[model samples]
Target: MNSSESNENVKEASSIEAIEDEDPTVLESSTSETEVDAANTSSSATEGKVRKINTETFIAEIFDYKANPTKWVYKGSKPAIIDFYATWCGPCKRVAPIMDELAEKYKGQVNFYKIDTDQEKELSGSVFGIRSIPSILYIPLDGQPMMSTGLSAKDEYINQIEVNLLKK
Candidate 1:
């Protein structure tokens, strides 16, 4: 083989090796974090099913709050859960799967949404005053939002949805 062709092959081989040599700790940390969040979120709704909301069409289906600067209006009708999270946050990763499960389980009853702090910083932070990751805000149709931090058990989430959201 010519010198140039041999060098290209060598470069490709090294790149693959570098990727394979990544630290296991980094991978474990991320995986465990996700697992933890999922465990916490799923704890509450073990029996209840949840529904997932599409970010792009959420406004059209639910309410047109996108044009409003406040981004929230308590209509006193449908209860909603807004999850503020970041991709790199360990706790956020842990809670994500649980959120998905809850969304599927609670499909038409309670609205579930995930807002990425890194991507929607201004919209999420400025409007919601989100100071930490894994912050869950439960908004009832008529009253103020009840905010909770950290990982909550599955039962708590289910109760919150049934009592606070579904009842109304």
Candidate 2:
């Protein structure tokens, strides 16, 4: 690749590193309500609140990585934002509220799910290569899922959903 492209790649990677001291509290953001109900009282795909998902649910709901080891086949009605986080992570804790707000805003339009990295060893390190605490997976209905490591602005996440998942 050319220097400019290489530099861009580096910058993107740098921004998505495993944030060790990122203060999610330092950032500001807003919320909404409509299209999808991500996580609610139940882990229904229709809508609700941000909910936690495990390896079994992931395989059954998201992608059967073990079934199709060579390919990425997502099984969901709408786009999803999978927050792979740990309870001990400060940044993860900060991100929790944002995910919840987004879950309500994008209700019925998107699915917001969280995975505990500490609990799901196979899913985190083996399946998703989660080198960081807050490695988020943005999965579109008809496209390959993308991973963004580390902490970032809530607006950035919104942009990713709009551009990559919502195709807006």
For lDDT, the strongest prediction is 2
True-structure lDDT of candidate 1: 0.52
| TM-score, candidate number 1 | 0.56
Model 1 misplacement above 4 A: 1-72, 75-77
Can you tell me which runs of candidate 2 are displaced by over 4 Å?
Answer: 1-46
Instruction: Give per-residue CA lDDT, model 2, range 2-32, as digits (tens).
Output: 3333222112211113323332322222231
Error of 2 at 152 (Å): 1.1
lDDT of 1 by residue, 31-122 (tens): 21232222234324532333332333345443445564434544434567877676687777788788778878876666676666555544
Quantify how close model 2 is to the true structure by its C-alpha RMSD in Å: 8.9
